[model samples]
Target: MDVKRWLEGVQPRPATATFIAEALSRKAGVKFSLEDVGMGGVITPATLELGLEYTAAAPKVGSQLLGLTRRDLAEDPLAVEATVVPSAWTQPLLTWLLSRPEPLPAGNGIQVNVGDSDIRAVRMTTQLFMKLDFQFGGGHARAALAQYYVRDVSPLLEGKFTEAVGRELFSAAAEVAQLLGWTAYDLGRHGLAQRYMIQALRLAQAAGDRMLGGRLLGNMSHQANYLGSFQQSIQLARAAQEGSKGIASSTTMASFLAMEARAHAGNGDDRACSYAFREAEKIFDSRNIGDDPEWISYFDEAELAGEGAHCFRDLRKPLIAQEFAGHCLELTDPFYARTLSFIRLVQAATYVHQSEPCQAVALATEAIEIAGSLKSKRYLRYVSDLCTDLAEYRETHDVGRFLEMVATKYPAL
Candidate 1:
């Protein structure tokens, strides 16, 4: 019954493990799935391999999405243990790129008609939730978003609508599902995030929203890069670019290219990273915001700078990283706490790379202070990584004080 023992790798009873995982997740500001804590038992390879496929048909995508959401609502343990299969990435990317968008099939269930007003309402609600996600962390209103999706949005998918309304409805639903995935990713629930993203991509495809589909693939690329699957990340980004070619607005293309640059930087391919970064900058500079889809309105200069900062930080170009990070911090909205925290961490890491332990510790402490207000595991990990970077300087007075402060604030770290 000692939680400390469970933290030390002692496996508890399944039911006990579930409670412990939830408790630990809350305490640590990171989601700990049953499998993450070693409570998952005898997971079949088949069950482990769910949610990887990129289906060709719209109906199949809808069915899969419903199943995913239902299992998520029920808190099914297997849903938490879903594996991130490396081989799964390539085929799906290929399928999505090679296939054309499928038309929305006729809805069968209820006679209820989903009109443009309903679609507009869904978009407005999703935009509000997206703003919440930006201002607060994903853990803030993720449950509410999920509940809304299941309760309100899911039914609309089954209702009768004209071809135009159906397309708009599916696109709006995809946006919600994509937000669900983004929230899960922010909470460090990568498996669940992957599942939602896959479904979102399918829904976007069904809606014939090529730009949105590309954006979903870019989301997958971002997640894959975060999970250290750099090659997969690169492929996913490229797939996004290829799949949306000629159609994607400049901003969306730039975002996809930025994701590719991130993957290249993570893989230590400096030349490739530089090439991609240049392309992203060029496209972004020429972007006509008026021509972009509503969903891609978030990828502005600040976001692009953040991505550049991350790329340079990973590539060990501290000076350039610091430059980009500074611009990102200046341009980013104060309401975007999580993003600012991340950019601050990137700046802190640049200081560490410059061998300025005192400056690094000061900046990192500030980042941790900002992160303290959020519930993002990824932000915590960023703080932890800064701590790791400062490990070599632990003997220094500034770093020692910083470490003590971190211990006081986040004992789990």
Candidate 2:
């Protein structure tokens, strides 16, 4: 947490034993015992080579999260790996370090040589902390943090950490990928989000977050539903519930179950949807609010109603769907804003299903504003569905105008 140590010109390297192993330590179970590893230790351009080896050799490897434990074929035995993800300025920093190398007696501490290898390592390590923030917090803040660090602090690192330091940095890069996936998910960018989420899942697997891995499955399930892969979504959700049964938050568990209900609704199984909804509701009712992690924290009485509305709408039960949709509020948090729009879009779909385009257009118009703010294509897809529903009500002038407006905005329409 002492980010200051990274801010250079300050010497007298900290004691070795106290060092945190960023990504590797998370896997190592205990903090790394950084006994001063002296000469002849060749560093790589990618710290992952070392981290992966460390992961593969650990005693409880396969029993752990990541299926990948060993280093890949691309790794070099003698070459020290660093990060490419860091900014260009960091390269000069290593040049400076490598140019002024001195033995400088590291009696009781680990000595970090100034070199490309070390600077790259520090960049990777910093990203790891950024990832930790994302796992605990939400995406907007995490993305903001990642952008800030990658652009700002990254320049100063200049890759001058020891192999131990490089390993630490690589861990951070994996963690960032994990968080980026979550951030993308919360933003409604289904396709791009999926890429980030899968990579994040992989990284967490490597980082040994069994709980995070399960959560990743839960996220994948949500994306599956958005893409109409409902069956796949349900299976993934169930997998998450089973995988992290003992460790995940009750809210997270319940949210996965709720997503499964949506999958059931997508498949037109009202019975299954109802069943899952009941279970999710029971869990939500029992828990105290604000205890849930922010990832699923958006699911509350109002949001659950909106979700139910979607299920009922999908199942063609307009009356029931409208009942739930009526209860959902107008939320505005940047992350939840798009979701709120989706809920309204679903509600609009329900109205359209019932042949009520006036209400559908009205709700959709509001939802469109929220969607327009997002860089997501899913919103446009939902709107396209809305326009399809609106064709049924083209007689009215206002409806015609709104339809025209949507048409103008999306030439694809």
Candidate 3:
């Protein structure tokens, strides 16, 4: 039956009719199962392992990407609820280190022709989504991005285009895929995020974009650190630096080094973290933004400062963490609520470490207020961590009030 017939309450319901109900549920913000929509029978969920491999071949990369995107569109439960497998990071990191960029596959006799204009439009749309992600957090437009990828960008990959156009198109697709992974990570969907990042790395390799590929590895390292896979995170960061050594711009390289520093801090390696931070700062000092790719434009002074703040916080350097956090707050754009909230939490944690509960409460309250508008699970986790840090001073009046406020606002925590 046609979709219109289903909407019009047709008598016979097809076995595949659940998709319509799923779409309606998402749109109306109301739960609708197959039974609720008058469609019966179970729909098997997509497997969690569908897109985890880092395929050495370009064609397989495309296939994996398609599979993952389709699963996302179908709203499979596993896509959102799958648990993180830290062991999955091992194979992808090894594959990236051992493999080189593969040549673009020839078109399969499709008559469709993709041009520069098509590539430009894809890039513009990607930029708009990226801006929304930075300003409003990843939960805002992730589904819309997935839909756009399936509807528009997927076909261009199979269509005929010149070598130049193909490279640009693949690069654009990689950006979108990376953003998808980032949004998933922000939502605390680590399994989905890992799959997207792995596919994105392959796409970047297909585009012969070593710089972007390195950045993707850095992203993996960041996620690994978040998951407490600190050793894997450090290894991935080193792989990113080694893989893109000669070609990466100063800003890109600095970002990679900072990721290394972050992983080191997570592992409690103070000396190694300090060395990496010094190198990142030196490289960033000499950077000329004009020479960098537009994708790396977000790694300015504020970003570097924020990274430092995170590193110091992890390394237990409370005073230095406060200094870096303060700098980051001063320089960050107000539109980036997520970033601001994270920095505020870092600053508040530093105060807790310094035995200043009142000051910590003030900063943490500000952070909570800023983050209240976001739909980020990661931010909530950060808030919970700060509250844990403040436990030693829970008897104090300010700390008690702060705990009450948090319990009132976020009973789940």
Please list the Cα RMSD from the true structure of every candidate, rounded to 1 decimal place: 9.1, 15.4, 6.9
Select the stronger candidate by TM-score from 1 and 3.
Answer: 3
Itemize residue pairs with steric clashes in candidate 3. Answer: none
Worst 10 residues of 3 by lDDT: 39-48
lDDT of each: 0.84, 0.54, 0.84
Q: Hey, what RMSD does candidate 3 come out at? A: 6.9
Per-residue lDDT tens digits of candidate 3, residues 1-413? 46677667553333366676788799999988655776532223433475777666675665567667766766667677767778877787777677765678655538568888988898889889888888778888888998888778888888888777788888888998999999899988888899899889888888888899899999999999999999989999999999989989999999999999999999999999999999999999999998898878889999999999999999989999989999999999898888999999999988888889899899989998887668788888988999899888889999999999999898889
Query: What local lDDT score does residue 309 receive in model 3, on the 0 to 100 scale?
Result: 98
Candidate 1, 129: how far from true, in Å? Answer: 1.3
Top candidate (lDDT): 3
Model 2 lDDT tens row, 297-378:
5556777787788889889999898888777754324455656677778888888888778888898888877655454445
Q: Pull out the clashing pairs in model 1.
A: none
| Best-matching candidate per TM-score | 3
- TM-score for each predicted model, relative to the true structure: 0.86, 0.59, 0.87
Off by over 4 Å in 2: 1-175, 182-192, 206-208, 289-291, 330-335, 370-372
Please estimate how well model 1 matches the true structure, expressed as its whole-model Cα lDDT.
Answer: 0.84
